[model samples]
Target: MSRLDARFQIDYPGFRFDVACTVPLEGTTAVFGSSGSGKTTLLRCIAGLTRASSGFLQFDEAVWQDDASGIFLPVDRRRVGVVFQEARLFPHLTVTQNLKYGMKRSAPSPRRIEFDHVSALLQLEPLFQRRVSHLSGGEQQRVAMGRALLTNPQLLLMDEPLASLDRQRKKEIIPFLQRLNQEFRIPVLYVSHDLHEILQLANHMVLLKEGRVVATGPIQDVFARLDLPELVESNVVGAILETRIAEHEPHFGLTRVEFLGQSLFLPQQALPPGAPLRVQILSRDVSLAVGAPLATSSVLNALEATIAEVSESPGDPYAVEVKLDVGCPLLAMITRKSFHQLRLRPGQKVHASFKAVALN
Candidate 1:
């Protein structure tokens, strides 16, 4: 396993931050939290742009930082690439030139990423001859990502890469980001405050609060933690499912997905059989029933589940969050009245139903 282990101690006038965690160094590992949570600071620390007063960081066999040994690699000495909120492309250069600039920085080696692969992965072929000023916000960002990839770094750091884009622009760029994870076998450290974006791209997560690492694990398991709502923003609390395309019902405009011995029908997707998919189910979209849902119901999915925990919803006195183990943990939000009426308690068997549209 390619793993990243880190411990940090940073101090300022009034604040002291202490954190430690180990995460797999593959796929997208999101650094998630709200404002002032030190998400960016952690990213900078990993990139060697910011030094933690007392820290240790290791990726597989390479030691990036170890304060105890007085070893601290500077940014230039590290094989890391960073993409900020802005594209930061050179306005006077053509897209080709900008990408070439990134390639120029890397030491010559057989492992260096080829320009063609980066171009195709990011869909930058058409923009190669265009000036940086001529591309749309999304296009520019795609170019920026391509440039980063061409650096052939061991790890890529993205600090809210989509923050500057509008909703439509974000939508336009998500596929490319997905490709970066699914198609290219590159390790990424994605920093973002937007839970929606994290849900869409991250496989694992590191949650921070006041510069401290509160939780770190597979995205699904981390989201299932009963203490999450109390530790971070509660509204984003939800579940993730790793599923495969089972079949498609073209006539009904829906597709079937199999997850943990259960099947769910979602809005039609053209993916072929066995294509892997990751879907998010918001806690608010889930409801609990004492028995299996009837066929007449509009809800497309319901599965046997057992209550794992019951906790108060952050800032919502009238409702409580229920954690259910449906193969994987599924979170549900229900009114206090319903909680009492159902007599819900841990280990109770019930059915969890959710509309397929709730799967994002």
Candidate 2:
């Protein structure tokens, strides 16, 4: 698999931005951080929009920037498609014309995306003849994405492309973004401070903290790490499990997914059996028991797990975080009072339970 290697350092009067990491060139890799964490700054360094004081960047075998060799590719020469917070479309031009402008500037020989295909992918045919000025916020963003895809870029850089939209608009645009990754197989560097967005869209993550790299790896691994104080303090720490639909229990109005021989139940899904599914299990939603509870309980999932680790929850001193291994890693947040009562320790056997309704 190809990867993007980048190292950059920039200094200003009161702030400095420094980052070094290599992320795989597949699916979506989210550049995640709070404000002033250099999320966008790092993205600009990769996009060639902001030149770093000292930097070296390479995409797969191609070196886009290297200070040692004095090689720096300009924005246009890099062949990267960028989508910003705003659509930045030409109000005077119709949507079709705007999309064609991107197609015209694309590299001709290796052109992989055509205008019609992009139009269909983004469902932009309805607004093609309409001026971008009259489109809704969500519709305008769809046009912006179509234009970017039409450029036939080797990589796509998005800086909070959904930040300006309302909840409904964000919902409307997320499916299109997922399609871009699934169907087109375009490597995307999506910059966003929203954890919800990262969880929904990113396969890998580059976590930043005050202009420094805090963590970078597959989303599941990164989230499971206990050393990252930044994540622990965020109070949203959890585990992401990749599973496949096993079967649907129509009578119970539930769907079953299997992961490493363990099963989890969720609300009924319209997707067919054998379809891929990614489920987010927050630590707060899980409970640990010394032994398997009776089947008479209302909770649906209760898997036998072995205690892996225990640590204080950074956000709440009174609480403790427990890591468990049930075919795969799982996390549970419980009060310190219960921690002492159970005397939980590593390598001990336990059962992890959570209500099926807790999963979405």
Give candidate 1's error at residue 82 in angstroms.
1.1
* TM-score, candidate number 1: 0.94
Task: For each candidate, give its TM-score against the true structure.
Answer: 0.94, 0.96
| Candidate 1 residue lDDT tens string, 1-360 | 989888888997787878888889899999999988888888888888889999999988999899999999999888888898899999988999998886897877677688898898888899988888989999999999989888888899999999999999999898889888776688999999998898888999999998889899999888899788887767555578888889999999889999887898888886798998777777888888887677797777888999999888867999998989998888889899999999999999998887644233
lDDT of 2 by residue, 1-360 (tens): 999999999997789888999999999999999888999999899999999999999999999999989999999889789998898999888888998887888788564887777788899999978878899999999999988888888899999999999998898899889878898888999999988888889999999988999899998878877665445256555577787899999999999988778888998887799988878787788888887677788888778988899888777888988888877677788899988999889999988887533222
Clashing pairs in 2: none
lDDT scores in order? 0.87, 0.86
Off by over 4 Å in 1: 357-360
